[model samples]
Target: MTVSDEDLAIVAEQLGRAPRGVRAVAARCPSGHPAVVRTSPRLEDGTPFPTLYYLTCSRLNSYVSRLEGAGLMKEMTDRLATDEQLAERYRFAHESYLAERDAIEPLGTTVTAGGMPDRVKCLHVHVAHSLAAGPGVNPFGDEALEQLAQWWPSGECASKVKN
Candidate 1:
C-alpha cells in the first residue's frame, strides 16, 4: 500500500472510531468536498453510536501531530524578533501558538478555551491579521523559525487557518 494508506491503516487499528467516510448526510456533502470536515460519533437521534469510533478520534490526533510540527507558531513569531532576542521570542511564540482558545467541544456545541486546533488555528489567525509589530512581530527569531520549519511537517498544516 502507499505510505499514507499504510499510515492510515495504522491509525484505524489504533483509534477504532466510526466508519470514516465523507458523505452528504454523513458529512456536509457526500459528493461535495468540505474543507476540514469532522464527523461526530453519534446516531441519527443522537442516541446510538457509530460503526467505527476511530475515524474522528484518529483524524484529530493526526491533525494535531501534523500541525504541531508545522512551525505555525514559530513562523508567525519570527516576524516579531530582533537579532539578539530571537531565541526568547520563538519560545514565547511557540507557547502562545499552542495555546488555542477557539476549540469546539466534543459535543460540538461550545468553544473551548484551550481546545484542539486552538493553538495552531488561533496562532494562524494572529499571523493573518498581522497583529504583531514589525521586526518584533513574533517573539521568535528568523533563524530559529527557519530551523523549526525545516525540522517540522512542511505540508498544509502550517498554511491554513479556519478563523
Candidate 2:
C-alpha cells in the first residue's frame, strides 16, 4: 500500500518527526489511522535498520510502555524459559522476522528486535511486529497487545494529533 500524505502526517505526529524508509502501512487502528508501519531493512542513509515493523501510534506506544513499566517483560521472560511450546513459537517469530528482513537486504545479523526467542526487552517492538504481521506471529506481541487499554476508544489516534 502506498503511504499517503495523511499517513505521513499521522506518523510524524506520532513519532515527533518525519519517518524514513517507510515501505507500507502494516496496520491501522480501528478508526483507520496508521498504527504500525513496515520500514525498510536498510535506511536511506545506508544504515542497517533491523526493525522491520515500527509502531507509530503514540497512544498505543504509551499503553505498551505502561505495560513494560508494570514488569510484564519479566513475567514473559520467565515463562519463555519454562514453556517449551511458547519458546518454540517465539523462535519461529524471530526466524520469520529475520527472513523478512533478509529478503529486503541481508543485515548479516541474528538480532531481531524485541529480544525474540529468549527474552522480552521491548514491548513496543514486539507489539509492533505482532500488529504488522498479524496474530500468531509473535506471542509476546500478542500478549502485550492484549494488555493494552482501549487506546483508540474515541476513534483513530490521528484524530487526536495536534498540529
Model 2 steric clash total: 0
- Candidate 2 residue 78 Cα shift, in angstroms, is 1.0
The local distance difference test score of each candidate is 0.31, 0.86
Cα displacement (angstroms), candidate 1, residue 124, comes to 13
Model 2, CA-based lDDT = 0.86
Note the clash tally of each candidate: 22, 0
TM-score of 2: 0.92
lDDT of 2 by residue, 14-121 (tens): 899989999999998877889899999889999889899999887788888888899999999999989999999999999999998899889898988888768988
In order of appearance, the predictions have TM-scores of 0.22, 0.92
What is the lDDT for 82 in model 2? 93
Cα RMSD to the true fold for all candidates:
13.1, 2.0
Candidate 2, residue 1: how far the Cα is off, in Å: 3.0
